[model samples]
Every structure is written in C-alpha cells, then in structure tokens.
Target: MPRITVAEQAGVGLDGAPRPSEDVVLVRPDAVIVLDGATSLRPELPSGGWYAHRLAGQLAEELAAHPDAALPDLLAGAIGTLAAAAGLTPGHSPSSTVALLRWTADRVDALVLGDSPVVAFGPDGPRVLADDRLAAVPRRGGGYRDRLRSGTGYGAGHLRALRAGGAAMDRLRNREGGFWIAEADPRAGHRARTARWPRSAVREVLMTTDGVSCAVDDYGIFPDWPAVLRHSVDKGLLSVLEMVRAAERTDPHGIRWPRPKPHDDQALVHVDFTEIPK
Candidate 1:
C-alpha cells in the first residue's frame, strides 16, 4: 500500500473571525481528494464552506461504495446528490473546486476543476496539473480587502458589489473561452482536466487547495513546484502555510499581492508510493 499524509488549517476571515476552513482532504486506500469551498457572496444561503463540507462527505461515501466508477461519473453523482439535499439552484448555489487522484494496480489518474492543483513527481521531475481559467475573468481594480477598508467594511454595499461581480463571472463559466468549476451543474465535471500515468512511473503525488498553492502561484515563495514538494516532504505542509501567513503579514494592505483576503483556508495531502511493489 502507498503511504499517505495530510495537513490543513482554517484561516481568519476579513473580520478576524476564526471560521471553519473551507477545505477538505480525504485519503482512501485507492484515492485522495482535496476540495476548496468558494466563499459565498450572499449570506442567506448556507456558506460555501458548509456546501463544500457536505459535498466532500458525499463524494467520499460514493467513492468508497463504487471505487471503480469513472472520475467524472462519480463527481456527477456527488453533485446530483448534494444539489438535491441543499436545494441548490443552477448558477445560484455555493460551489467548490475539486482535485482528485486515484490509483489502481497498473495506473494513476488525476482530475482538477477550478484553481486547485495536483503535482505528479515522476522520472521526468514534477508536473503541475492546474486549471487556472478562473484567473482569466476580468476583475475590478483593488482587492476585496481594499474595498472592505474603503468605508463600509463588508457592509451591505460591499456584499452587493460582490454579488454583482459573481453574477457577471457566472455567465462565463463552463463555456467556450470561459472557465469551468464544480458547481450544481454536473457538466462541469466533464470539463475537468484528466490524465493518467503508468503506476510504476509515478514516484509520488501532491494535492493542494489554492490557498496552500498560492505560495508558489502568487507569492513566489518557492522557485518551483519541485521545491514546494521538497519543502513539504521535509518540513511538513504547515511550514508552507506559515510562510504564506508571514508573507501576507508583511503586506496586509495588498501592496504586494493585491488579494481579496489576507489569509485563506489551506489544505494539503502528500502520497508516497515508493513502498508499493513495482
């Protein structure tokens, strides 16, 4: 069997509230899953974190029951189950990003939706598999933090602006020239990027939510994906989280990165396959 380890932490919100992390990590004998819940703009419905937690639980159950189901089919089933339970309406519900890796005796498979990432370390080195179409959307100037500090401080106006922005972005999802995400729509799952590798060729794998990966993606804390993996293997994933927090602390005003929130929910799972018999 392969050896697997995981690390995660919830971050403080803009109001300094210690909310539950919106990320989920699940390690099964045959698969590893990581999910990142998107923050909700509307306060009426259950939070994105709540939706993500529920969805993750459902996915785990489904995957365990039918381990051989195709990845897209499993995701579709999970989305269908959750949409009914949460009374979610198409294009109007809280959603999450999905990153999954599954292995069999002969091969390994990976799928990524939204911005979450999966890194495969093989004989060729490290290959980062990420879906970054979300980053292509046209965003307004000034980060969410900047708007919060503007005058209202996350007041009704701020929320309205957020809702408007989200609505505008929704029109572009899962379409040509637009990005795809795992929402109430099962079709999004088909849009996810999937790849397979010979089991013997893969040495190890790493899966992470955008929060943890932002260190390399946004902060430039590490030189590359291999460095990030080496640091995680040596010092644990929390070390990377601390590095991100420290860097954000130095630029709380968004002068450096210009992000929405100071800190985000972080989660990571590392799978070591060396012990598995070749």
Candidate 2:
C-alpha cells in the first residue's frame, strides 16, 4: 500500500570511465530491496557488483515464493543458495550490504546489514535503522587519509593505500568480533539489524546505499535526514543524487572528503505509505 519511486546512477572509475553500478534495487509486490556491493580489489575473485546482481535475483525469488517467511531466514537461504551455485568461498568471496522494507496488513518491517541504511519517518519524527558494526571496527590500514591530509591527491600512492586497507578488512570479514556482511557466509543475514513498526505510525520510508546516504552521512549535502526526505518528496530522489554528484565533482581529489573514490554507485527508494495495495 505504498507508492514507490526509485533512482539509480552508475558511478565512474577513478579515471572517469563509466562503470556499471554495483548497487541494486528490487521491488517485490510487498517489499522493497536494496543492496550495495563492496568493490572488489582482487582480480582473482569476481567483482562485488557481479555477486550483488546474482544475489539480488536469488533473494527476490525467495521473497516472492514465500511471502510470510522471516526476513533473516530468507536472506540466509538466498545467500547460501547463491554461494553454492557460484562456488564461492567464505573469506575469498565478494560481499554486499542489504536493506529491506516490507509492509503487511497491520505493520511494516525493516532490516539493514553492513552500511546501507533503512530509515522510517512518521509522527515520531525519523527512526534510523542502520548497522554500524563495519564503521565501529577500526580499519587495519588507512594511511591514505594521512597522505591526503598532507596534500597528496588520489594518486598511485593513494590507490596502493586503498588496496592495502581493503586487504586488511578482508582478513577480518565474517569473523567473530568483525562486522557481518552478505557474503558467502549465510549467517551474516541472521546478523542483520531489524525493526518493526505499526503501519499507521509510518508515513514514509527511505532506503539507500551509502552513495545517496553520503549526502547526509558524509557529504553534508543536506542538513539532516528530514531535509533529505523533504527535498526527495518535493524535487525527486534523482535530484538529490545529482546534488551529491555535483559535490563529488567539486571535490575530485578527495580533499574535501577523503573517500575511496570520487563517486560510488548510488541507489535510492522512497516509499509513500498513503496509497492502498493494488
């Protein structure tokens, strides 16, 4: 019973070459699904974007076949199914963030894994449902930030530092005390943060990959979450993404905001809960 509008843009590589977005947004009859795949650094392993595309399809199928199934079970099953088919290994495989929002007759449910967030807005203002574990875990290597602060832009040294950081994180992935993500491991799904609310209490729900979220989360493109919702509903979600891209263009060297790249693939979905289920 909600009206959903979706927006997406493929990000450019460091060289400004157009690349396919790893983020995926899938809509089931009663659910909204979003995923942000981690960029792959190793040439031996399939890219994270490839993994995300297949996993999204599998998860969509599982959700459609079992409408009343638990979210965690569905997620685990989907991940396991995909991994088996792809012959993916636990530590060697690619991973993705997961966000889901579903509505039933009386209530709505939301889930978040990795950094992608699911936000619900209503009379209580905004309730942000996000998984902060990945951020909480300190990175093993981040010398690039130091180098950038010292006046070096996104050069070869910066890329080497980036690869080192990714390799460090890979060592800790899916392990106890490390953050969980939707990778070859099925248990990560069970680790997803989940929340439920009365359908009447929710007026709108916003789901996004960190690309769009960086506007508030990092870019400060908007003042806050409520402002994001206002602008999205007024101008459209695509407009919000354009603002983010504009900001990225201004800070091409990662000086203004030290990030892995100039831009990341973005996906956003805004769901209005006023309409009846068709």
Candidate 3:
C-alpha cells in the first residue's frame, strides 16, 4: 500500500462570520480524494461551509463504501446523498466545489466539479486538474426555475461557463477577477470535469477553494500552491489555518500580501501521494 499524508485548514474572516471552505483527502492503497467548498455571497442558501462539509463527508463515505468505483459514479452518488440530506429547496440548499483523485497501478484519475481545483506535482513540474473557474454558480436565471440542481451549484456552474466559450469566465480566471459569485443560481454551471496525465508516485496533490488560488500570480508566488504545501507539511495544516487568521488580523489591507483577493474564507488540503507496489 502507498503511504498518504494529508493536511487541511479553514478559518473565519474579519467579518466575524463562518465561511464554507471544506477539505477532505481519503487515502487508499492506490488513490486519494480531495474536495473543497466554495464560498457564496447569498444569505438565503446554506453556508458554503455547510455544503462543503456535506459534500466532503459524503464523498469520503461513498468512496469508503465502494473503493473501486469510478470517479464520476462516486460523484453522482455524492450528489444524490447531498440532495437527500439537504432536501431540494434552493432557498436553503447546499452547494460546493468538489475534486476527487483515484490512483491506479500505473495511472491516476481525477474528476472536478466547480472551482475548487486539483493540482498534481511530480518530478516534471505542476499540472492542474480542475477548471479553476471563478465562481461556481450561474447568474442569468432566476426564481424557482433557477434553483440549483442536486449535483450543481456555484463552483460547478462557474466551471461549466468557462468550458462553453464564455470569454468572461476565461478572462476572470486569468486576470484574477476573484473566485466567488456575486449571486447564486442553478443554471450557472461552469465546467463539468477534466482529467490529468497518468503518472506514478505523484509528489504532491492540492485541493483548494478559490480564495487561496486568487492570491497567486502567474509565477505562483505569494503563497503559491507549492509553497503552501511545503509549509503545511512542515508546520501542520492547522498552523496554516491559524496563519490565515493571523494574516487577516495583521494584513487586512492586503498591502503586505498583495494578492488579487484581499481577504475571504480560505481552505486547502495538501497530500503527498507515494507510490505503492501492485
């Protein structure tokens, strides 16, 4: 069996309120899973943290029950479980950003729904697994008809739009327009999914909400994913969470941090995926 090590962090913002930023890394002999919940601006629906918690918990549960299942099937089951658990009412429903990783003997499989992204690092360099959509939900539709579906929400819609030739979505991602949606709706699907290059002994895997990604520049400096992973592995994920809290306290202006996104709820998980003999 391959050894898997995971570290995660989540914290409240200066607004003194809870934001949804959930993470999960399930280690199997062959694979691991990572999920993140996107934060939302709407007050009517369930908090992003609530949705992320449910999705990550349910994903972990389903994967545990059927360890050999495909990534899509597992995601479908998670959606059903989430819908059943939270009910279908849009006013008080759950939504989030989800990413899954399944490693096989000679290859690795990944599935992403919404903005929370999966980044894989090996001896070569870094490759992203998810769409990195700005927001996870749609905005045009409205009323009961716009109620988000069981398997979709802010993160999902945001990604779907990007994949559908929506220039705004692409520009938003490239220029750091921010990862959150101004509004929440069902039709707002971003990108459905993406895969990764097959490889063994993945050195590092990351699942993070939009908040953290927005902080990075083209070179990935100023708390880049790699740097974040190293810090987590050394000091512990909880310590990183505390660091975000402290950053909010000391550098609320973002003058020192100087990231595109000044502040918001943030969470991330770092996993070191070691190779195992088949």
Give the alpha-carbon lDDT of every model.
0.81, 0.88, 0.53
Predicted candidate 1 versus true structure: per-residue lDDT over 1-278, tens digit per residue = 69887888888664556888888887777898899988876677677788888888888888898988888888888888888887887778888999989999999999998889999999998878888889877676654545755643444555566667777777886676888887788788888888889998799998989888888888999988899889988898789888888988887655566555667889988888986634
- Per-residue lDDT over 1-278 for candidate 2, one digit per residue giving the tens place of the 0 to 100 score: 57999999999665557888899998987999899988887778898789888988998999888888888889999999999999998998989999988889799989898888998999989999989898888854347777766668877887788778888888778888888999999998899999999999999989999999999988888988899999998999999999999999988778878887778999989999976567
Model 2: residues with Cα > 4 Å off, grouped in runs: 140-142
**Which candidate comes out best when scored by TM-score?**
2
Candidate 2: pairs in clash? none
Q: Write the per-residue lDDT of candidate 3 for residues 69-144, one digit (tens) a residue.
A: 7666777667666666667443335456666777655677777766667788888777776664544434344221
**lDDT value, candidate 1, whole model:** 0.81
Candidate that would win on lDDT:
2
Model 3's TM-score against the true structure: 0.61
Model with the higher lDDT, candidate 1 or 2: 2
Candidate 1: where is the Cα deviation over 4 Å? 140-161, 276-278
Ranking according to TM-score, highest score first: 2, 1, 3
